[model samples]
Target chain A: MLDSFYVAWRYLAFHKARTATLVACVTLLAALPLALQVLLEASERQLRARAEATPLLLGAKGSALDLVMNALYFADAMPAPISMAAQDQVDASALALPIPLYVRFQARGFPIVGTTLDYFDFRGLEIARGRPLAMLGEALVGAEVAARLGLTPGDGLLSSPETVFDLAGVYPLKLRVVGVLAPSRSPDDRAVFVDVKTAWVVEGLVHGHADLGRRADDSVIIEQTEGNTIASAKLAQYTEITEANIASFHFHGDPAGYPLNAVIVVAQDAKSGTLLRGRYLNGESPHQLVLPGAVIDGLLADVFRIKRVLDAVIGVVGLATLLALALVFTLSVRLRQREIHTLFRIGCSRFTIARLLGAEMAIIATASAGLCGAALTAVHASSDELVRRLFFG
Target chain B: MIRIEALEFSYPDASLKLRVKSFQIATGEKLALIGPSGSGKTTLLNLVAGILLPQRGRIQCQDVEVSSLGDRQRRDFRIRSIGFVFQDFQLIEYLHVLDNILHPYRITGALRLTPQVRERARTLAAQMGMGDKLHRPVDRLSHGEQQRVAICRALLPSPALVLADEATGNLDPCNKGLILDLLFASVADQGATLLAVTHDHDLLPRFDRVVDIAEGQSRS
Candidate 1:
């Protein structure tokens, strides 16, 4: 038996290309389904943990999935905007503590999250390198954003414009990066968080420009009427907020009427959360109150359903590949007929010939198994990052 | 060393048949069986090696009845007492020169491949002028060198009888003489009998006896 293996090893080693191709095919056939399962399990853990941590969500009457994805994950899809009065209503009900979110902009490729300081406490985020957000327009960058853009305390981050050609539309705001949050290993790691007022400034809802009362530059005036001076399109507006120009910035409309994307409601108790849900069930409310955990569970159900179909497809392909491998072995035996004849002429028994072929197959299978094991170990280690990038990107 | 009496055999898939009335080879004798193509020269060689069973005959090699032995017993007897050298050399392409020489030991448990056997193989390769190329693949060797390797493999077991089926037919005239000399020298050194089959008439004079295998080596 040992001599059989020795001869078999020589035969396989002599055919380098055929041996390598066989190993690669068998390894991939075994590793694909296993890697997919690892990633899906990781995705489930990631999606559910974030959702179950928050009790309820309040947003404009629309897709609860979209609202949860945006408010909790800061996803690119912006749900229909609700007014700030929704957050006020949640607060007035005395049932939950509502954290307002105005996530409607981007800085570079990362999402710019406009939220209150209460969100930091709710998510258990802490400053790692700089101070917290204390004043308007001061930005606290996430750990991943800071590392990717090489940002540190006292640096500046400019909000991205919605469009370069939106000349009369939203203006880009320059925010001061006062701190960098520690790595939370969640969606917050990839965000740039700021006070909601800074986001409104980026929206051109409230802005500050040159004072019209002092007509120091008459040439900039488009029209002057009784007791008021109208400015032209070239009026010098403050893009970066500083101590000198902070007082000049002001809001134009009622604070309750401002646009908000969603509100994360943390109820004081289970009864309060249930009552909040009951309020939205009345059918006359403009906003929808959702339990985020239930929304994620439904999403996972659909994912698992699709997973079943994928599993079936992979099974068929695997079976086909196994059949092809068997055919290859059969053809190889046929091709080696002359060699077999020589062995028989030299007095090799039938059982000995079969043992030689079996040894060759055992070596190939062992090599493929080793390669598959290494590949699975690598996928298992990186499943978390893979899920975050695949599902939430 | 070999005797056949009233042998009759035919392949199951083919209509070709072979018959031998009576034949005998003396111990330590070198005999050559000569015939045209399609004659039963190589079939007689296989019968003497116990690779094919006779339908109605008895073949005795060194007092052992090779014809009456079962399939497994014939295989065992053949490996223990007979060595074969083919015209094509039949060397496995994937193995190196030394590995090709030692292949017979690996195919059967009846041949115990020990350290002494390995050393003898190396010494035999050295004598064949292939010591420097022992690790070279057989496919990379010349026709003459490959035949030399086959001769080394057949003579390694020092069998009592060596079967050569057109061993020198594939070589050139110069290589033919040299290969026949090497084979004759090895058989003489081991005091073994040799039964070589060939169609080449020029090399018949070197054997001790010659038989024309028309219809068969032995006839009624």
Candidate 2:
């Protein structure tokens, strides 16, 4: 047996290119599916955990998937924004804690999520470096956001302009980074968080005085003027709100009607959850109460349906690879006919020849399985980052 | 010692048949089998080594019935008792010279590979002028060196009988004589009987006896 193995190993080593090609074929057939399964399961676990953690979601009646994506992923395809009065209504229910989420803006490709202070406690977000958001115009950067943008607690982030073509559009807000949150291994890891009102300010729902309350003493300008008290186009809009000018910032409309993309609701108990569901049960209701867990489960069912088809296609490919392997083995045996004859003439039995072939195949298989194991572990370890870059990029 | 009686052999798909009524070689005797290209010189060697089973014959070598043994038993018996050197020097190309010489002991449990056996292989290589090339692959060596390696392997087991099938067929006249000298020297040193099949009559006078297969050395 040892002699056969030595010969087999030497034969494989002798044919370096053929051996490598065969090993690579087997590794791909073995590892690709395993890596895919690991990534998908990790994604499923992350999606399910985030969904289960948030008990309820309130958004304008539309696609529940979009609402889930916006609330959980801070995805760019935002649904229609609903008024803050809906959040007030859910809060007035007294059966759930409603945390408002306004996600209409981004900073350096990272979503700038505007929510209340309770969001940190609700989502179990911990500030890794500095304190949480304590004032308007202050931003809390997630771990990934900080790492990718190299922004520390004392840094500042300017919101991206909604449209470069809209010259008269709302000026981008320059937010002061107050803190950096620890890694959450979720969408939050890549987002920037600020008070909801700051987001409203970014949406042009509020503004400070054009000249910031400066007026010429001799000029007769009394509240009916355009350029009488206005500053230049550059200084016409407040790029940032500080303690000195914060008082002048005022909403253009009723503050209750401020738009929010979605509201995450944590029900007090089962009965309150039922009552909350009942509140939006009517077909005529403009708002929708979504159980994020149920929505995610539905999405996963569809995802798994596609996964099953992919697995079948992979199975066929695996079978074809196996067939090709068999052909290669047969060709190897045929090519070594004279060698086999030599072995036989040297008093090696037919059993020994069979053993030699078996040893060669077993080595290939064991090495491929080992490669698959290593690849699966690597994919599993980096699955969160992989999904984030792949889906969210 | 070797004895054969009533040997009848033929290929499964050919009309040619080989018949021998009786033949014998004494212990430690050197016999040269001379025949035409298609004659039964190599076939007789194969029968004696238990590599081929005769249809109606009993071949006994070293007091064991070679014709009556099973395939597996014949293989074991052949490895333990008979050593064969082929016309083409059937050395595994991938194995180094030392490993090719030790091939017999590696294949059979009947031959245990010991430090002594390895030492003997090295000594044989040294005697055959292959000591410096022991680590070289068989395919890397010259034809003469590969033939020397074959002879080294054949003699390594110290078999009771040594069979050479046109071992010098590919060698030049000078190298051929040198290879025959090596084979005879090894057989004499080990007191092993040698049955060599060759078409060269120039070397016929060296052996103790000449068996002509075309003329029917033994006919009933």
User: Comparing to the true complex, what docking class would candidate 1 get?
Assistant: high
**Per-residue lDDT over A1-393 for candidate 1, one digit per residue giving the tens place of the 0 to 100 score:** 999999999999999898888788789899899888988898899899999998899998989898989988887778999998999999998988999999989888888888999999999999999899988788999999999999999998899999999888788889899999999988899999999988888898878886766657677898877866678876789898888888889888797999999999999999998888898997888899998999999999999999999999999999998998889889989999999999998889989999999999989888989988888889888887788677766
Clashing pairs in 2: none
Question: What DockQ values do the models have?
Answer: 0.82, 0.58
**Docking category of candidate 2:** medium
Q: What tens-digit string does per-residue lDDT give for candidate 2 at B72-111?
A: 8899888878888988998888789999999888767778
CA shift of A263, model 1, Å: 1.1
Full-model lDDT for every candidate? 0.90, 0.87
How does residue B181 of candidate 2 score in lDDT? 93
Candidate 2 Cα errors over 4 Å, as ranges: A147-151, A158-174, A201-232, A236-250, A390-393, B217-220
TM-score of chain B of each: 0.95, 0.96
Cα shift from native, residue A238, model 1 (Å): 3.4
Task: Give each model a TM-score.
Answer: 0.91, 0.90
DockQ of 1: 0.82
